[model samples]
Target: MSYQRRLHPNLHMETDSQIKQPSGRWGQRTAYTKAPNITDILAELKLGHRVTPVFAHRSYTWELQKMLRARPRPVFDLCYLDGGHSWDVSALGVFLADRLIRPGGLLVLDDLDWSIATSPAFQEGPETLGQFSSDEQQAKPVRLLWEEVLPDLGYSHFAIHPNLGWAIARKRDTKAVVPAD
Candidate 1:
């Protein structure tokens, strides 16, 4: 008998990981962005056979939802959501991750208070609220998800690890029923 573990569709990928180098000339400026592209990261990390890497460059509904529809359920033990900063996008990720994560699985969210307008961490954006005032920046999506959404979704409240700017939650156990004679 042989057992082979398959990479989830989200992590499986095939790509040409060659990024063109820049000449750094006046006409040919630097050909690099602040963040490395998905293919670049995959090649750098050497995650070829371990998992599938789905670059969700579009709306969650369009990308994640379509993927979920094709793949089997309860496939993931942990999901880290840190890409999108808006409430709606984060909420969508959480909802979808809920279906993908197995029972007793863990879900982690990043950027407890990470809006460009509200966060003091970024100096370039306009400050809607006072910087480092109430720490309301921490409350936007992080608190709303941890304090409100998780409990409603049958996930136990885990500590929001502030140092790493993440909130963790675990799927709760199902209620047991006693047999009646």
Candidate 2:
């Protein structure tokens, strides 16, 4: 459900040597120096749980598209988009997640507040992109985006984490038919 750093052997070995432990399930380390790992999603799928992990960057997109295109339709029950932070990218991510999620499925957006909190660079007229921009000129747009624009979209559900940012969305209607394989 979330990305985590890979601990070095020295750190991991200290935990327990006696027991045969279950391996961790999340993706590869955040650096992306190595190949992408979706072991968590794979494990979930193996257990008959649906999963969809978005890879917004070019490198990840190439890999993700290949994997998704080969899978049966409506393969995901939920999606969490914590990838890129650009406005365009965020919007696209929401759109894509909307398409992939099953009706009544949840879609979580990490760092939505982060963009609003730090938005001096990308300006939108009189307002800043976030609530706390470095420049006064930028703060208005930031507040407007988070407080007004996002709400106007009628997402129907939202949770704001003081440290983590926002989780915004609405569940699609479950009455819609899922395509038969």
Candidate 3:
């Protein structure tokens, strides 16, 4: 949210996430901040009118699926994906977001270097061990998507910032036509 604020101050952003404090490591941290969700931060900053917050009742992936089903056409110029870093959640979410983003729009994937094995929150969990293989746990899912998925989807001007742990790609401008020789 702060990054979006800094990048595009006037942009009216639609943010989606589970309303409750998250279930893992961040949930414990939220107890200290008292800002359980984005809603609280919006209230504190008084940016409610500028930013639309959609709280997911089920999960972020479910909410994104709902958005794709309900919306008739692409609505956002920039789709910033920061939720659901795992392949199970993110792959589907990014695919849906591709449809949600308008032509010539930007798709920003955050935490490109993130992986279950490296994440302190999930590294020691039995659930993580069962769900992800050793390679899957170590694999950078977002970076994998950036390289393997987005290129196949035909997005242009791909930029990867390893140090910053994020990547950006632009949906092709469908309206543009090439000149014949």
Candidate 4:
């Protein structure tokens, strides 16, 4: 988002400019690095008031649901899913994002091939061991969602970059099509 802002300094996030962070059960990850607060990072980037910071009191899913309920129509143009690589969280996040994003909107899912079992930061820790099963630890949840879930949902035009470990797909337009007779 900061990079996008750099390219288009006047860009506004509009209604969904709020930054949603994790909380509760989903927030119990062992931090391998001390990262700066997102709001501070955004502020440092001079993202300004256009970017509202809303920390999740529960989970990102809960906050997204609330946003969905408040809005009568799809508004966001893009949604980046990079947190909570587990199926329990990421899957539902994408589902809600489908409703939140407008037709033809971009949905970027990061760490497509990332698995807890292979993560250098988490592989040795109890977080990877006790929190996930052997299969879950080895499985790529983002990749599964990208291949199996998005196609069934209303997304197309995929661009999967394995080297970069990210996938981009556009939400399908829901307009009616006139078939040739």
Worst 10 residues of 3 by lDDT: 26-35
TM-score between model 2 and native: 0.47
- Candidate 2, residues 1-181: lDDT per residue as tens digits? 3224542322110111121112322333343233224544345347324443444334333433554576565445556555445554455555555556666666666555444334333433224333333554223332334455444543446455544454655565658687999
Candidate 3, residues 44-129, lDDT tens digits: the string is: 67888876656555466777777777847537888778766789788988888887888889999888888888776674455646
- Winner of 2 and 3 under TM-score: 3
Tens digits of lDDT, candidate 1, 39-124: 45546667656656554433444555775787454367777766455567677878887887777788887766565455443443
The best candidate in terms of TM-score:
3
> Which candidate order results from sorting by lDDT in descending order?
3, 4, 1, 2
lDDT (CA) per prediction: 0.58, 0.45, 0.70, 0.69
CA displacement after TM-score superposition, residue 41 of candidate 4 (Å): 6.9
Model 4: per-residue Cα lDDT over 1-181, one tens digit each: 4553443322222112232222213333222122434554567778766655555554678878898888475477788666567787889989988888888789988788878777655643554367677899889898899999999997985698665567999998777475889
Query: Cα deviation in Å at residue 172, candidate 3?
Result: 0.6
Off by over 4 Å in 1: 1-48, 120-139, 175-181
Model 1: ten consecutive residues of lowest lDDT? 12-21
**Model 4 error, position 74 (Å):** 5.6
Instruction: Report RMSD (Å) for each prediction in the order shown.
Output: 10.0, 12.8, 5.6, 6.8
Candidate 4 Cα misplacement greater than 4 A, ranges: 1-53, 71-74, 176-181
Summed backbone clashes in each candidate are 7, 10, 0, 0
